[model samples]
Target: FFFSAFHCRGIRDDIEEEDEQVSDAINVSGAAPPKLCTSFAHFGFDEQLMHQIRKSEYTQPTPIQCQGVPIALSGRDMIGIAKTGSGKTAAFIWPMLVHIMDQKELEPGEGPIAVIVCPTRELCQQIHAECKRFGKAYSLRSVAVYGGGSMWEQAKALQEGAEIVVCTPGRLIDHVKKKATSLQRVTYLVFDEADRMFDMGFEYQVRSIASHVRPDRQTLLFSATFRKKIERLARDILVDPIRVVQGDIGEANEDVTQVVEILLSGSDKWAWLTRRLVEFTSAGSVLIFVTKKANSDELAANLTQEGYSLGLLHGDMDQSERNKVISDFKKKNLPILVATDVAARGLDIPSIRTVVNYDVARDIDTHTHRIGRTGRAGEKGVAYTLLTHKDTTFAGDLVRNLEGANQAVSKELMDLAMQNPWFRKSRFKGGKGKRLNIGGGGLGYKERPGLGAESSVSYQTLFLENCIISSIFLKSERKTCMMLSHCRIVASAAVCLQPVALKVTANQPPELWGIACLH
Candidate 1:
């Protein structure tokens, strides 16, 4: 019942997929999928909402919006799985505006008619801005409540009577407890970046928030990546919800040109950044993502010393300061910004032309969101990830994502990925107790005596990429695999050997040959 659709952007179609197959059709499951809405006009939205959409210059509904909007309008719960920057915010927000308008106006002291929860404060603020932009025609009063800002101010705004509230989990919970706001009136509930919320350990807070909302509320959960935990959470919250999946989860954004650079070590990143800093800055706004808050500050200080006027943003900064930095970066006053993953998820700045990963992300999901900061709203973007040997733990997944998006995988990065201990274990499926004959003096395979369970080389085959193994058996320097010191290579005139067979592993590519040599 699942149908897949590609993000209708300038994605490359000519590149042939040689690894795992990636489908372009958007998948919709659960009951009958709602009819896809080709345009905003199909929704028959309020005139004011239509005007705001037109003013936003939306040419057409995105893949997620096409299917998600209709499902949401049906008043059924929904789980939207799509790549980042695929208009997921609007997929739920548009329907939410329609839902809000249909409901009676909020009485004094009543909480928001719709409550949208996000993972980060930045995302909370961004969604609140969207609520204001689109809800203006209906005279909607939306307030953003999140941590880092003054609690008194947020409480005052909430107490002033808001029909829409966009906020983070902790802050929202605080307001609910203090009686500053109530979820009793929230009929339209949204969990934006649901996976991220779960990742940040907000599962309890999210469940707590949802518990306060009416059980029959129309719930929407959207995310770029989904996990088993998220699925479990969805089951607990949503009822008979239709699932709309656009593009592959954890797949790299095809609209962004991804480049991976293998460095000698982590320390070399500064030099690499310095070399391209001016070029990237001159082109357009650049966002440099680091792993730690200290890294962001240190990098920003170094760049400042080099006379580059850049902004620094991290969790350590105060909310007001961070807001100013984001504002400056967005307004083009600061062309360069050094930040941690705090700005990675949902900071929608169209001016971000380039994203440089000063440190490799810890996981594929985080990496996906980090690069997603650049390529947004159908604009072409470029992202560069600087990797060292230490970061090759996730190199295999990175290579797969890159290949899945038809992005170029550098030979250095590919080699490291293959050599990585984790990748090797996955590739060979934990080579243990398996034995194959290694040729000695003769060209044909012969069972060597006493080469059974106790043998050092227990693996049956060895995988080689684009390497040439001659009659001379080069020592197997790979730490993951055992060396076949007992066997000797015999030169033969016949190119093809006898019964010794070769086959490709399921996770690996066809070109990756698994061969047991005459050694």
Candidate 2:
């Protein structure tokens, strides 16, 4: 079920303008002292630290950074629940870097001071990159350790004495067990995307790694959602830490427009999907969500065979393969990526314009995370769900849960379900099936051989031109719809050749003259 409350415009401009005015009024009258840099500046950070921030082009601090940075700098534990892409990485990294830089020099055999554990290798690499960028001016050293790569290289980096280590739980634990790296002297420990790690069944590994770290170290936990499990885990790890909750859990971004299309089992989901792709032709990139890894793989294969530039990612894939797929997808070399839940967590891609749930998720939490992939960083995004009869109950449960969270389902979506057929057998069991016979042509559009007298509007012929244009311009949505709409308008216009002029009069909205002429 699509929810109206899930659609939000984010930080209303009017409210922001009002706040700016109020702030100016207060400042002009000298009613309050300017907010001092009581946070980082008070911590005795060197000039190099400030210079690094300036070089990184960071103009202002996010709320997490503003509050959590100081506390973490003070060597206190912290638990933060902020929305994805809220600059949480920097919040933890900056203070950690400051501490490392202030140490001036380490003993000949002193180990790393901080160890940052992320759920995915991608996130581990991302965190490592950000740390390096921020620590560049201070000449601080950092290394990323994750599976799917040569351990030799990572060990070499570790042997060189990195002050900070960003790693995935499993790989880091491997190193710890081998005594290749030691966290005995580490002063700070961070669990980034804590919920995802638990969901991915990394609890044991994370706990094992944590046990190796000093118990007296400051522990920081950051996640988008804080369920009972996450809260309990935080309690076990953090010591009387400050809690900062910036957004509601499982809340969809307001800037995303969500729609649900109910379809019968026999209905061609591919056709419906093709139509939606056309509608969102101008969107930068699209992520299609499927239930199983096999389905994601098959879908990507079929789409690619149909001439669509596509990529596939799933847990079963090797780390190197997954990294390549993600890299290609992010660079827009592959416009579409079929993926499972693994890609849904802590993967920040700002250019994703749309998300399509080819199959409804089994649970509300999964649904929330899938759609949350788009509509990031204050950008407008769209999400569509292709629903079938078998998914009704699951969809209903999801809507009910959202309602409980103050998000109401859209009545329009519920009504839309009635028009679609619901009970057709799935083409594939567990989403494993042969690729459909989508003929190859320019821009994923194949021309059919036969044309009849009554075949006035051939989707193949009409869409061929549109597809070429769309592919060249990256307009998948427009390609899907332009042909159909053009055919309808052309047929109607052929019936009457009268000069019909649409006009917008002084005070009236524009009126369509063709409809009157049709009558």
Which model scores highest in TM-score?
Answer: 1
- What overall lDDT, based on C-alpha atoms, would model 2 receive against the true structure? 0.61
TM-score of 2: 0.69
lDDT of 1 by residue, 322-401 (tens): 99999999999999999898888899999999999888876778888999987898899999988888776677777767
- Report lDDT per candidate: 0.72, 0.61
Q: What's each prediction's TM-score?
A: 0.77, 0.69
Q: What lDDT score goes with residue 479 in model 1?
A: 9
Q: Which runs of model 1 end up more than 4 angstroms from their true locations?
A: 1-24, 428-519
lDDT of 2 by residue, 1-519 (tens): 642432322223333343343223111101111121213333334576678777876666554555555445544566776656567788888777755554436555556888999888878888888889887867788989998878989988887788899999999887777767788667678999887798789999988877777654667888766666776776566554556544444444555666767677725688887666656546678889888988887788877777777888888999889889888888988888888877877677887888998877756566766777887755677888787666655554444334433444676444432333330122122211111111001111111222111111111111122111100111111110100011111111111111111221122322221222111
Per lDDT, the best of the predicted structures is 1
Instruction: Tell me the number of clashing residue pairs for each predicted model.
Output: 7, 11
